[model samples]
Target: MRKEIFSKKIMDWYQANHRNLPWRKTTEPYKIWLSEIILQQTRVAQGLPYYERFVGAFPDVLDLAKAPVQKVLRLWQGLGYYTRARNLHRCAKLVVRDFEGHFPNSFEGLKKLPGIGPYTAAAIASIAFREPVGVVDGNVFRVLARIFGIDKDIASDAGKKYFFSLANELLDEAHPDIFNQAVMEFGALHCLPKNPKCDGCTFSKQCEANQKDLQSLLPVKHKKLKIRTRYFYYFIVRDKNKMLLKQRNGKDIWQGLYDFYLIETSRRKKTAEVVKTDAILTKASILKESRVFRHLLSHQKLLVKFVELKLHSTKEMNLLARRSELKKFTKPEISNLPKPILIDRYLKANP
Candidate 1:
C-alpha cells in the first residue's frame, strides 16, 4: 500500500473512533511526558488514575522536583515496577536543575532526560513538539508486523529497528503527531494480540496476516522469560501499636521499599524451621502465623509467609530491633512509607 494512503486511513479511523484521553488534549511536554511514562507497560484503564493523581499532586516539573521521593513513592504505592517512580522523580529533578524546569524541545534533548528512551523521546517529540518522528511501541509493532507480514521477533534489537524504520517511512510528516496517535490507537483498538477485529478492518483485504491466516503467528517474540521461585519468611515483630520495619537497601527487587524483618531461604520453611533459624524468632512470643501467600511478578514467583510476634517488655522489643537492625514505626507512620505490594496486602489483611 502507498504510504500516504496508509497514514490517511489510519488518521481517518482515529478521527472517527479515538478515545478522548486527557493527555491528547494538550501540547504541554511535561504532561505528555508524564502520561507516556505512566502508560509504559501499563494499560490506559489502570494508568489513567495514576496520571491524574500525579498531575494533581505535582502539577509541574518544579513541583515534582521539590517534592520528597518518599512522598512520590507513597503516591505510587500499588503501581509495581517501583523503578519508574524513582526515575520519574529523578527526571523531574534533572529537568528543574539542569534544564531550568523546561523540558527540552527536541528529540535529542528529551532523550537526555532519565527514563526517556527512544520510544518515549519520540512520543514526546512528535506529540508535544511536533517533531516528525514515529513512536514504536508494542501496539505499533503488532499492527505493523501483521499488516506487512513481517515475522521478525519484536524482542530483538534488529526487529525493533526494522519496525521503527517502517513506521517512520509511513509517517505523515505534515501531521506526525496525529498520524502517530492514529496508528497506535488503531493497533490498540482493532489489531489486538488475540482475536483481532479483521472483518471490519480498513486494511483487511490488504493485511498480509489476515489473508494468510497468520494473525497469531506474526509479531513473533522468541524470548521466553525464565521464572525464578523465591521463599520469603517475614517476621512481623510488633509492640502495642508499632511494628519493626526495615528499608531494603540491597540491589534486589523492592529496593527503596519498607518491609518486615525478612529471612529468605532457598526453599519454603515451616514456622518451626524459621524460628529455629533465627535467635530473635526463638525468643519472641509467636502471636500468629499467616497462611502462605503466593505472589507472582514478571519473572519471580514468591512463596511468602508472615510470622507475627509480640513483645511483652520494652527491653525485649529494643533487643529484637537492635539485633534485627530495624526501626519502630507506628501504624500511621507505616502507612506513609512506601512498601512492596505484597507487604501492603499482608498488612491490610492482618489489620
Candidate 2:
C-alpha cells in the first residue's frame, strides 16, 4: 500500500518533472559512475561541464583506463578533491583489466572498486541496473528525515544507521531507477536546505517537519570541524623568460597539481627567514624577489609565500622553458616539471 502511493506519486512526478540531465539519458554504468564521482564534491552546474569534457576526451572505459594519470588529472584540474580523480583513474584501469572495460553490475562488485563506497555502489546499482538498492545521499537524508519526522542527529553513527535502514525499507523494488531519481530530485528541487517549498511539495500533506513548523530543523547535523592554518613559502625560480615549477608530492591536498618549490613552516615566516633559509633555497642557484599569497580550502588556511629565484642556468634546475611547454606536461609532469600557478603569480606580482 505504501509502496503503491510512493510509486504513483513520486514516479509520476519524476516522469513529468525530472530535470534534463545528460547522465539520465542513458543506462551506461560507466558514464553514470563518472557523473556520480564528479558530482560528489561538486554541484550539478559545475560538474556538468567537467562531465561533458571527460566524456568527450575519453568516451569509453577502455579509453579512460588507457589514458595516462596525468592527462586525467589535467582534465580534473580546478575541480579540487584531486584524490577523487586519482581513484577514478585507478578504478578505471582496474575495471579494464579485470572486468574487461565493463563496470561491475553488482553492489559488492562495485564496492570493490577503488573509490566506490556503499552510497556510490548503491547509486550505480539501482540507477544503472535497476537493483532494489536505495541511494541515501545528503538530499535523500533531508527528505527522509523531514517526511518521517526523524529527529536524531544525522551526523551520529546511530542516526545514520537508522536512516540507512529506513531508506532501504522505503525503496521501491519495482522501479528502482525512477524511485531513486524521484526522491533525490524532490529533495534537491523542493525539500532544500533552506526555505523549502512545502506548499508545492508532494509529501507536504504528511510531512512532519511542515506540520510541526520545523522544516529547517528536520535534518539535524552538528558540524565539528578542526580548522588548521598552514604557512607555505613557494619558490618561483626562473632563468631567462622561463620560470620554475614543481609537482606537489605528498598525501595532502593538490597532490597531483603543480606548485612552486615549497618551504612550509609552523608559523608565518618573515622575509629574512625566507631569504636566509639555505637548506630550502639550496636547489635554486640564484634568488630574486619573494611574493606572498593565500589560498583557502574547506578546513585549511594556506598562507602562501612566493620567493622568485633567478637561476644561473636551466641545466641543473630541471624546469620548463616556456609557458607553451608547460601545457604538454600533465600529472606525471608534476614529478618532472613545475606548476604554472606559482610562475603566473610571481610574474604578475614581480614583473
Strongest candidate by TM-score: 1
The C-alpha RMSD in Å for every predicted model, in order, reads 14.9, 15.0
TM-score, candidate 1, is 0.67
Q: Per-residue CA lDDT of candidate 1, range 40-149, in tens?
A: 99999999999999999998989999999999999988978899999999999998998899999989999988899999999999999999999999999999999889
**Distance (Å) between predicted and true CA of 298, model 2?**
20
Tens-digit per-residue lDDT, 1-351, candidate 2: 275676678777777778999999999999999999998857899899999999999998899999999999999999989999999999999998988888889888899898899889998999899989888889988988998788888899998899888888888888788888898888888788899988877877777898899988889987789789998876665544455454555798777667655668899878557657654355454454454567668998877776666555655445333431232233333345444454455545565
Query: What ranges in model 2 sit over 4 Å off?
Result: 225-351
Steric overlap count per candidate = 0, 4
Model 1 regions more than 4 Å off: 225-351
Model 1 clash pairs?
none
TM-score of each: 0.67, 0.66
